[model samples]
Target chain A: MAFLEVASITKQFGNQLVLDQLDFSLEKKQILAVLGRSGCGKTTLLKILAGLVSPDRGSVRVEGQPIQERPLPERGVLYLYQEALLFPHLTVEENLGYGLKVRKQPKPQIALQTERMLYDLELSAHARQLPSQLSGGQRQRVALGRALLVQPRLLLLDEPFGALDPETRSNMQLFFKKIAQQYQITAIFVTHDLKEAVNMGQQWALMEKGQLTHYQQLKDFSKDPKTGLQQEIAFWKKIDHQL
Target chain B: MKSSNLLSIGLVGGFLLAILFLAVGSLATEWRFPALLPERYTFEHWEAWFQKKAWMYYLVLSLLLSAAVSITAVCLGLMTASGLSRDKRSFLWLRLSYLPYGLSPVLYAYSMQFFYHISGLAGTWLGVYLAQLILVYPFAVVLFFTYFDSSMHHLEDQAGSLGASRAVVFQSITLPILRRPVQTILIQLFLVSWFDYGITSVIGSGQLKTLTLIVYQYIGESNLIYSSLASCILMAPPMILWLLQPSRSTKQDIPV
Candidate 1:
């Protein structure tokens, strides 16, 4: 059985249906990138998985246990947003250490882990700075560090690098992949960018108007005409030739 | 001059005029209608006002009442706003929350007189406090509702996902984020209650004397010197608070 199972999730707002009988599953340490246009229920799906929103009907199961009714802490899920959203009141070090502090980890361990994360993210010098003091990329790095320190069962990224410039976005994407692989973190990242989805996810899915279509491999995702990945690749190639 | 410059000058000019009036009114020993200026000035009224032990009591009473009402109103408002912002169904009640603020405080106090009488709260400190709270807490509610926007909800969700209990989320995330706005709102509510005359008189039934009531009484009795002295005393706290407030540029640093 899949390690994380999302079964028949349905959500509606007023007369409009946002998610319709959505079902999917992921194995241990697998990253599933979901690509969708705006208002395609991508955020709604992530919220449901994070337990921020309750589905109209359906359930989520992890390791054969139902987590749909469980509170947030018990679910062990973290959702990272496009905005860095570092707590303005906290320093970079404190923001990174937040989850550990909340989990009541030993002070020394928390300090050691946070310090290591600061160094790894190249934010050691700016550890004492507030969120407002940091550049957009640095803030996002701190947010990622915060999520990782908690050792969540699953990490959900909702276009986490969308706000960054191209260079910063590329750097963050590579850094994310490296850390996720090293830690063997199970994740589902949502993005509108086709290249980002192909680069990050082992399994891919396309969401359109609340329905999800799963692709087993990158080859299938790129080859599928309905997804327009092939056409997109050709357009980029044409630009490359002109350049 | 730019409109902003004009507005600033107007505000400063108004404040200076008020101060000038207070000084002239308090110091003048006698003034005939034919003169623009007072004929004679004396410090005796100020000295006499300061020497009166009862004036101190009135000042202390006003301070305590305003502080209590503002703090209580802010706490209650924060709770109400948090609940209302989180639940879509509760938003319908937000319009109703403004009803108390829409009515004049004296009228609202009059309407509550029957309830206060039955509860034996009429003419009591508790009665006056409740009356001010009804008038001011809604403003706090409205302010907090606007402060705690949709973006704030994301922070709450993020905290919860990080294994924080609800209380932990509030203390660690929400409260800290809200501190500046809360402080601003608290001072505003305090000033609202501090300057109040009608609600206090109506609710306290002219029994509980505050600095405002004293100022009103002196003004009505044509005790202009005493009234101006009391007015000076009454205006001091809010002036200090305004001076101490964060500057406009720094205000943008606050999230909401």
Candidate 2:
């Protein structure tokens, strides 16, 4: 059995069906990039997995144990939004230590772990600054470090880099990859950018109308017309030929 | 001076001049219309009122009533606004919150007087309080509703996901974030209750003699000195609130 199993998840908002019999599974330490356009239930899927929204009908298992009925924090799933929602009142050190503080960790452990996270995020120089004082990339790094310090079983990222400029986005993506590797994080990265899905994910899936199609290989994802990879390659090739 | 600077000085000068006029009016022995200052100034009115202790009585009563109304309204309003922010029927509820303000306060009090009379609350301090609350509670709700927006809810969710319990989230995140807005709304609602006349007159039934009602009494009797004294006293709390308010640069934010 896979490390995480999600089966027959369905959700509806009013008369509109948002998720229709979604099914997928992930191995330990694998990153699944879910590619979809706007209004394709990508956010809903992540929210469901994170236990923020209840699935109308579904079962989710993490490490052979059911988690859908569990309370949000107990579910060990953290969902990151497009914005870097650092607690505005908190300093960088305090924000990084928030997860540990909430868990009622001993003060010494919290200080040690928070220091480590601040160092890892390269934010020690600005530890006393509030969120408003930080740059966009710095804030997002703080947010990511805060989440990683919690050591959640799964991280659900919903277009986390969508608000960043292209240069910042590329840097964040690389930084995320480095951290995910260093920490062996299991994540489902959701994005509308096909290239992001191809580059960031070890496993791949495409979602349309609440239905998800899993791709077992890179070539399979590339060949799938729904992913727009062929069109992307052709366009890049034309630009290359012109140049 | 620049026109803008002149305008600012003019406004402050005008306000101070008005307060001085009231102070002189409260102390005048006899002042004719043409006189710039009082013909003869005396402390008799202030002395006589202090001896009777009537001013103290009304001052304490008004303070207690407005404090109770404002504190209760702010607490209840915060909870109601938080719930309403997530509710689908929020627009309808917010619309209803504005309904009480649509009518004149006196007319609104008259409309609700029957319920107070039947409940045996009319002509009591409680009746006047409930009456003012009818006006101020909804005002508080409307003011606080905008403070609980999508971003605020998102932060609460983020806190919950970070393993903070509901109580922890409220204590650590919600209350701290709401501190400034709560303070502002508390002062606003207090002033609303402090200066209320129409509703208090109708529901208090001449029995609840708050400072505002006493000031109106002096005015009705054409006792200008006592009226001025009471009016000056009535203005003190709000003026203090204004003076105590933080400057814009130093003011802490509330809503995310």
Cα-based TM-score, every candidate: 0.94, 0.94
lDDT per residue (tens digit) for residues B1-256 in model 1? 8999999999999999998899898899886677888889999988888888998899899999999999999999988898898877667778878888667888888888889889988899988998898889888888888766777888887888988898999899888778778888888899999999888988798889999898899999988788888888988889888887655412224321
lDDT tens readout by residue for model 1, A118-195: 988889999899888888788888998899989999999999999899999999999999889778889999999988
Candidate 2: tens digits of C-alpha lDDT, residues A91-188: 89998889899999999999999999888898899999998888788889998999999999999999988888899999999999999999999999
> What fraction of the genuine interface contacts, i.e. the true contacts, does candidate 2 reproduce?
0.49
Q: Rate the local accuracy (lDDT) of all candidates.
A: 0.88, 0.89
Give TM-score values for chain A, per-prediction.
Answer: 0.96, 0.98
Maximum-lDDT candidate: 2
User: Where in model 1 is the C-alpha error above 4 Å?
Assistant: A233-243, B1-7, B249-256
Worst 10 residues of 1 chain A by lDDT: A219-228
**lDDT, candidate 1, residue B237?**
87
Q: Score the docking of each candidate (DockQ).
A: 0.62, 0.54
